[model samples]
Target: MSGTLNQILNGHLSLYGDLPPIPIGAYDSGLNKTQRQFRRANKISLLEHLATEGWDHFRRQESVATGLDRYHPTKLPTINPGVLTSKYLLLVIDGTTHRAQSLAVTGGWEHVVSCSLANMNSLPNLLRDYSAEWISICHASDILANGALHALAGHLQQAKTNTVMTCDDIIVRQLWNDGLGYEHRQYRSSVSAIRLCTRGGIGGLLTLDYSLFKQCSFAPSYTCLEALRLDVLLQITREPIKTTHCHQALVKHQGSKNPSMPEQGWPRERCPFSDKQLDEIDRIKSQHAKQYFGIEGGLKPNPLQAGCHDLSRPTDESSLVSILIPFRDQVELTSTCVKSIQQNAGKSCNYEIILIDNGSADNSTIEWIKKAIKEDNIQCIRLDEEFNYSRLNNRARQLCKGDFLLFLNNDIEFVSESILDVLLDPFAHPKTVAVGSRLNYPDGSIQHQGVVIIPGERRCVLEPGKHLKEQEVIA
Candidate 1:
């Protein structure tokens, strides 16, 4: 296998003139005509297997001189694998019939446990019985990336007693009609954002102290069990437990390439949660909002779509907001923006507009700024220098008095009266950091729904819903 693989690799390397070919070793045993034919036919599959087994090796050998950074692999966090001991346990949860195949991965582990789909209810008791200090749980379908086990074990050993650690997951799905499975897409794990975006939580892999599991309430029914990790995380948040994500470890999850397939845990393509499940999630979120932010309200159903909340909360009368707008010489646009904000600042919260004059050379713009400063709610600051977006915002932010800051462009004119309320609604949850809105062109065409930065060299910044009709609803 090694000799054949080396020859296949060399053949590919020959195409790139600068690189030297890896020397292929002589075969210890002669290959039959049928074996040689099979090897040639399955070359691609063999290469994929090799890549999966040694992702770290290739990642480390990245060549900056050759401009190979464009294909940059995920940076692996440093970890010592010496932590794995008999006291640590690996638990495999397999819902499929491939039990023996799944158990094969845990061959060398000193302490390993497995639970079938039907026996999932007994997991809590099993944890109590096991005398392990740390426990790592993964699905049967998950294929651990090279060095993932060691990385996980190391993280478990070093993490705090109350910490719950999870690794990154790469979702692979078979797309072709061939019996062999090939992945079309790779998904970065969303487990780290569980605190802010609870709905994005995905199950399959986790490592944590055994005591933490004992404290968390396991799912009693089979339906809830599908999203078991999320339930555990929700319970963990109620306490002082710390949730950590290990980017060094990789877990490959085999899912369906067809979007129509109903996935159980995460909301990958569509809403995976039932009405009852969603209600339960909303109830918990409401409780947390009240407890943490002193905000009282349940999530209202989204009128435009099902399985999502409108995230609207009652107006917080006491909270103050600072709206910062930076402008140069466009007085008309600036005037329209300020006027719209003043007229549309709803009863959601108290607000003040801070207009930053960034070297306005026009007399009309300077005069407008002077007159705008006279208002009690509006403040004007003159920075007659080169414009820096960050510098302008920071200077205004330091002087402004508000619990939250809203950065606005000088050209933005609000058409909706409840814009502030809608934008601030997500902030009701303590963990939400920022909120964004959809922007439209003058012709009633979509400018952008949001900016998405993805892992790539070219076209990293993607604008979804661009050029679409403004009336069209985006999922």
Candidate 2:
């Protein structure tokens, strides 16, 4: 590993050099911080070389190519290369204004059919006419990303029964909400299908087993019929279907020309819902949660309009949470954090703040800690050893006396009164391992919304949408 890295660092060798290609195990097995640094530095060049000449070289032989090349150009010459032999069918729904021909169908589809609010009932009938094993549906206005159809076809190979696969979209133009720009909306795996079903449809670019359509009874009046109807159908049925949002950006939304178009209910570009619609949406959301997740009242009362479920154990009412704060000697920051918790803890449940002091030497901080311990009724533990963050939290975890644990930093200050409840709501589900909150800087800029992984020659972590305004939500 060192030798290969040195060659790249010193510009002494190419990927075609005497050494074999860097094995995937080389990343995991042998590498110190310096060795890893060298690999990270040269990742871009290595990836670019692999994509062009190296990939072409391997693909020409076909036998020597890695498993990663299955979706490459050499493998799938066209979207539906073997439509006659393949069991999958790509069905494009030609909307009222945008017909199938206007769409970027370069990837290709098996068939295109006209659809409207009047003829929405004909969907099941149209689906029944197809003899394909798996059926993919998309709107005519929605452009297919390069290799999207082939990717969907590839996905169906191992897809389970009742699994509806939706892909991330690149929003080309959205005139609604006074917004017009390009944005890639990537779905989070942790987000529940129930949360999306009532809010909005996933999108038109989705594929499922042909038979799964039979399980849903469509209402003729539903405007956003393509993907929304299918999603709602899966939710209403007694049997549950897993909603898998593909990580690949497989669809491109051409954007809605008008804001008020009922048929074009794309995720971020939808018009405002009427009071009646909101009521109906809320009722459906509550019903789904009560039926599926066994939440007592459907949605937990949260400041965030998209209410979450309280899936904690039924018998254990009012869960006691232990808030763990680890700090070294920033007395001012620590004081503010404690004050915020005291003021905005809300009425969710009882909680105890366990402040772990990691060898604070400042006289003011030590004095404040002593006063806080006696007056604030908060527990304080002193670790006189070297500052080890993980060790400090682990030590505090041992003394926590709550049903759930919240590891908070001393630099954090709550802006929302319901922050604690919002954080605890997801814990209602017993299988939940952990929940993360969107953090913002003091200046109202995002500190962290979520962590995303960037896969390359070497995998790396990215804090995407890190510095965006607090108002802008990432999908």
After superposing candidate 1 on the true structure, give the runs of residues whose Cα lies further than 4 Å from its correct spot.
Answer: 1-84, 94-101, 104-108, 114-121, 144-148, 174-199, 202-204, 222-226, 242-244, 256-313, 326-328, 342-344, 356-403, 415-417, 430-475
Worst 10-residue lDDT window for candidate 1 reads: 20-29
Scored by Cα lDDT, where does model 1 land? 0.54
Error of 2 at 121 (Å): 4.4
- Write one digit per residue (lDDT tens) for candidate 2, span 1-475: 6886654322233243222223222212222344345446767443454445444544453322232222122111234443433465665554642465344255555454455544567777766666767666666666666556676667666777767776654444342455423233433231244334323434436676667766666556443433344345435344666555566666655545211111112222122334444444545556566666554434543223322122332333467889999999999999999999888887656788899999899999999998888754489999889888898999989888887788898999987786667676554443355667778887665676632121211111222244444241212
Give the deviation of candidate 1 from the true structure as CA RMSD. Answer: 13.4
Worst 10 residues of 2 by lDDT: 451-460
lDDT of each: 0.54, 0.53
Colliding pairs, model 2: 311-428, 311-429, 312-428
Which pairs of residues collide in candidate 1? none
What's the TM for model 2?
Answer: 0.62
Error of 1 at 44 (Å): 29
